[model samples]
Target: MTRLIVAAGGGGDAVAAAMLHAALYGDDERAVILTYAWDRLLVDPLPGPRGPHDFTGLEPLTRSVLSVPPQARPIPPADSTLPRLAAELPHTLALLDPHHGAQGITRQLEELVDHLTPRSVDLLDVGGDILAGGDEPTLKSPLADALTLAACAQTNTPVRLLIAGPGLDGEIPPDDLRPLLGPHIHTFTTADTTSIAAVLDWHPSEATAMLTATARGIRGTCEVRDAGLPVSLTDEGPTVHEVDLDNALDRNTLARSVMTTTTLTEAEAYSREICGFSEIDYERDKAARLKQQPPAKPDLASVLFRLDEFQAEARARGVTHTTLRRLSEVLRLGGSRRDELRSLMVSARPEQYVAPLWRIA
Candidate 1:
């Protein structure tokens, strides 16, 4: 079961600070922590993976913070962990000027998709106020809606939304946000304080109740209970938000979050479904390369033979038997390998590949 926790807050409310805490400890337990930013400090570290091995699936997505930290560059595998590190988008769609770029925001949609190509995850925007572009009173604020919707449709994940502080305006009823979310949606909330003193007086249980009620009220078409875990509002604040999310959202949400930014083909999906197959491919490639050794010039014939060998190895490892229709897609492979892998897995039923020739005898 996957769980997705979307925490939203206004600037300096420490929304990511809250969500980051949840992400660090949530992954192995089948939980994902995500946040959206209007503006924030880039150098600040959220409570997340100390290292890659801490959790099975964990990452962060941001829309550019105050200052870019050395570790905050939007490049893989760094970008792989953090999706949507843009500075900002135009307030209104009409305001989108090719030359007048938004500050501290990820300006490119393709960049987000490419970054999240690996994990199967869900999308969560932390602060709705910023996402809605601050009630800028223009029809052009659809960038957030556009980005969120596109993220859901393209990645096949429903986005979890958060409404905080002034964001809960009259024009946009929280309930309306539900229908917009596809079947994969999951939602949560956390404490928001105007000052450190207010933060000190916050009650964990009471805050959690508010989050639970908010989730129920803002419920989307997707069955919240079926797709996610029960809400748990923690007083631990952003430091432990990820842990709280792990306990709240279920496996379905977690799976969605990892895939939210990922684009998969039938082949890659197949590889994921068939346990041990990917490991087999890795080992086979490793062994083949080792056999080739180094310094040896390859003839055309040898190269052709090597290609044939690779194909045969793939078949033996159950790659060729997949139901992926776009066989030519794999042949044209460059960066689309991820999608191809998913397609192959989702395309064919494993039963059809039972023949000995395709199997390792």
Candidate 2:
């Protein structure tokens, strides 16, 4: 029987969903992942999530639902990793278009269920942000996850909410999430990460990278994202916990508000009304600023000096490791120069440790 796995917040959640499928079913080709084309501002540069019109060569899974093929490409001005993910992952990767809002997404999901005839539907969230109470001070992105919750609430199939790597997103604190999480379902083993190892090399997902690192027995304080948010990596970082779908909807005030939204604009308005702000607004502003003044070329000496300064402060706070993505931001390097930065760092400091994460020292 096939299993329908929805990547709740998109981006790295899709990567985590692939890992979850492998861990639970083990080489089963019956897993289908439905995810959004929303990525970080550094990756996509676009303000909102890319829809069907933004891609080429998408195969229709249903009259309303479309599946991303390995050959699919995002139209110019719209960037996405879904096409590459489809090529790398073993299961079919279907696009989750949120432009039409919660009700529209519900219809698409219902159509997909009817077409696939899957035995189970699961919502996989890489970080526990899907459980946000909507007022959490650290919550940065919640609209997409809330939209997914609201859409899944209307689906006929019984949906299971699986939260992996609690607090790894640096949104909700681990202490705050302890009371809300349900029974632990599975703790990812090293073998579980085998399918995503190659994908992580090029994927810019900070949370999923931390999750995979934790599963590989790495434990320490990891600073991730452009914000340099410090997340504590522990044994809990590799485990998946199930939350009741109804309970999740109850906790997510924004999701409840957008349950009947007919357009993406309406849903975003509710997000701002309930959560004080919408992530798309932040992305739009950032993208505009980047367009006004593109990132400057990094001076090797200045970059190394800034890195040392940042490392000193991070170490003082007990931070032992950081992702290359975060390091790129720390060094004032643009997304395009990440590889160049890595090569420079490696050649300059051959003794420095490197993997999915680089040693901060």
Candidate 3:
């Protein structure tokens, strides 16, 4: 399914991580729908742009490769406008403060919502209450984040507060954050200095994949662009499909395209080998990469599996794997069932295991 992952900050590495994971291992065909929420509020829509615009509705500064809207395209009734009241205190004060009330901006905002609703769009406040600055005047209404979550129950789409950046000290977590987040929030922090394993402990994925700096020596200060991951021989490395990022903003169009796209057949074998390696190397290397320390071995099992899967596919399509390690590797991996194949390769009692291909073929 075409999934929408909305992140709060424009420089959201967590969203990037999610996108990279989706690119590598998602089912059917997939694309990363990235929206920079903070940017949407501050920037004006560009002239024309296609693909997933950096901000929803706001096209690129230049003309787009495809047809799309200029303002943030409200998802009609489904769209929720997560106001930055917590984050934008000065702006909120100007709007709600008595002296500036003559501008009637609050009424204008209300009117805007009224106009958009007729178009089947909704504008909601989707964010944390901590940004509200805890000032009573600022919190004139229910926190936007809370309001947005409540609004989700009324709409067909799920809603979440997309927080960004490294500082997460006072953010008011959703009462139902876990339910609304549903494995979507990505955390980037400076306090995780103990090890890669410790930092990953906080992740829902349980360090199945480690996010490290490319330099391999910096502690607790990893750059998003330089982030590294040990190759687990899985498709969960990077995005395999070339998404324009602009076209994917529209939920309906992207959803339909993903339904018809073909998945890479080699994903099964790669996942199997990656799983086996993760278990075998868990004790030694998983913690090493966490602390900005180098491990004895560079785990490129993911890459290795991808290569082998490709070779095996070629062999099945009438190619050959007669070279040195090719034949034995194929023998070791009898079929394509990831979980069972991994068990067969790694289980203590190898004799008791049977390849699924033997039962079927």
List TM-scores for all candidates, in order.
0.26, 0.95, 0.23
Instruction: Please report the TM-score between candidate 1 and the true structure.
Output: 0.26
After superposing candidate 3, which stretches have Cα over 4 Å from the reference? Answer: 8-28, 32-37, 40-148, 157-361
Report the lDDT of model 2 for residue 165: 95
Query: How high a TM-score does candidate 2 get?
Result: 0.95
- Cα lDDT of model 2 overall? 0.88
**Whole-model lDDT per candidate:** 0.26, 0.88, 0.24
Tens-place lDDT per residue, model 1, 1-361, is 3344322221222323233224333324433233333211111112111122222232234231122222343322222212222122101110111111211112333333344442433333332322331233321122322223333333333333333311222223333333332332223332222212222111111122223223323221110111111122122111111111221222122222323322222222333342213222443454354445432232334433543554565555444221111121223222213233323432442443221111111
Error of 2 at 181 (Å): 0.8
| lDDT at position 170, candidate 3 | 17
Which number leads on TM-score?
2
Q: Residues 1-361, candidate 3: write the lDDT tens digits.
A: 2333322222122223243333333435332222223211111122111123232443332121111232345342222122222121111101111111112212322333332332222121122221332222212112212212222223333233332221111123323222222223333222222222332212211111222221112222111101111112111111112211122112112122222222211221222232222111332242343335321221236434644564455445443212111222333321112233333333533331221111000
**Would you list the rank order by TM-score, best first?**
2, 1, 3
